[model samples]
Target: MKVRAYGKLNLTLDVLGRRPDGYHLLDTVMQSISVWDELDIQTSRQPGVHLQCNKDRLPTDSKNTVYRAAKFFLEDCGLADQGVYIFIKKYIPSRSGMGGGSADAAAALRGLNEMFKTGLTTEQLMAIGARVGADVPFCVMGGAARCTGVGANVEPVAPLPDCWLVVCKPPAGMSTPRAYSILDQYPLSSTQATPRMLEALEAGNLKRVAKCLGNRFDETIRLAPVRALKRAMVDAGALGSMMTGSGSSVYGIFVSEDQAREALETIDSMGRTFLAQPCSGI
Candidate 1:
């Protein structure tokens, strides 16, 4: 089974309080982008999971989300005796807050269900995915949604208006845990980012939607390359630009593909770049 796992972007991320379990509460609007990681999985009678990746640095053992996800799903299906050989071809940049690992985990669950003929519904798959990662539920469902409660609770929302976007990851990546730790030092903002973003999408006003772009983590992380990427996007004609998720990667909402391409080139030297649009769920 071959699955294309799409990466995500946070148009608006608001930090709430933290739970007793140390999980930070959040209200973030998520959208799946065109950037993706491809997984080719094959089942075998041998009772163990083997994994490989194009990026040699990425772990292929239990440390990898893909391997863990396969194990979890197989155990759930009462197929623990089954084995899978999984290969990942990565396009989405890691450690950029793009949910690359979560996406891979989600894809493994979905592909395994199909390959083994397990009739798990989307909700079931998403529920199972949540155990693997906080963002895995959203990645499993894909497309647009308001994710809250440590990003496992996903409420589907209207897709963003058709448009082009440019995403760039700075040379240095941000640690999600470290980013959250830094953000925890600050108080929660009164600004209602997700509500306004929902309204903007519902109204089908791209410009208004662009104005809704926001992320609390971006405010906390003072990375120079991130700021430069946003600045170049704005100067090159982006409607609005901001860092997605925690940090490292920044994206710009553009009026046209041409403008998006220009912004990509403008900031390409600063880091890795991708030109994409909001897409639907798997």
Candidate 2:
């Protein structure tokens, strides 16, 4: 079986608190975008997982999350005899707070489930995914959602209204560990959640949705070049814009397709650009 896993952007991410497990508790609005990776999996006569990818940035070893995920699932279910090869075509930039790797791993799990007919429930898949990474579970079940409890707890949120998205990535990658450390060392500034946008989404109000868009990470990430790109996009005509995840890539939401293309040209980068829209579900 083959599956295409899509990347995610955070419109609103607030670190609620640190957990006893040492992972931070989070309250974030996550939206899946069109930027995606494809994973192909099928039963193999060979005895173990074999993986290949066109992206040199991605490691093909067992250290790779997708390889680890397939191992985790088969070992957990005593399906070690099943063998497979995964071919991944990646477009999402790595470590840009875009959840590319996590999405790839989730896609592998989903493909395996179908190939094996495991009939694993969503909760079961999520539980297995969580063991791999905090964002893994959420990626497994694609869509817009409110994620909490270190990304394990996912509550369905109304999808953001149909809008064009322009994403920008900076040259420097923001280390997730470093971002966490920075947050730990520094006092985090607070921002109000976009309850109005959430309401707008539920009501299918595109204008209101654009008006209510917001993210708390702006205070930290905006100190860098990424903030400038985001500003450029907005100034060029994005209806709404914000930094996506921990740092680096930012997205501009636009009402008109033509407006979105214009916004992208304003922020055109050697880095990367993904022109996409809000999807209903994963």
- Per-model CA lDDT versus the true structure: 0.90, 0.79
List model 2 lDDT by residue over 1-282, tens digit each: 668889998877877678776788787778888888888777778978999998876789887889988999999878998788889888788867889889998888888888888999878888888888888888988888888878778888888777888888878677788777777765543555645556777898776766666655566545467767767877988777777778678888888889888877777763677789876425
The top-ranked prediction according to TM-score is 1
Backbone clashes (count) for model 2: 2
Return the TM-score for each candidate structure.
Answer: 0.98, 0.92
Give the worst 10-residue stretch by lDDT in candidate 2: 186-195
Output candidate 1 Cα RMSD.
Answer: 1.0
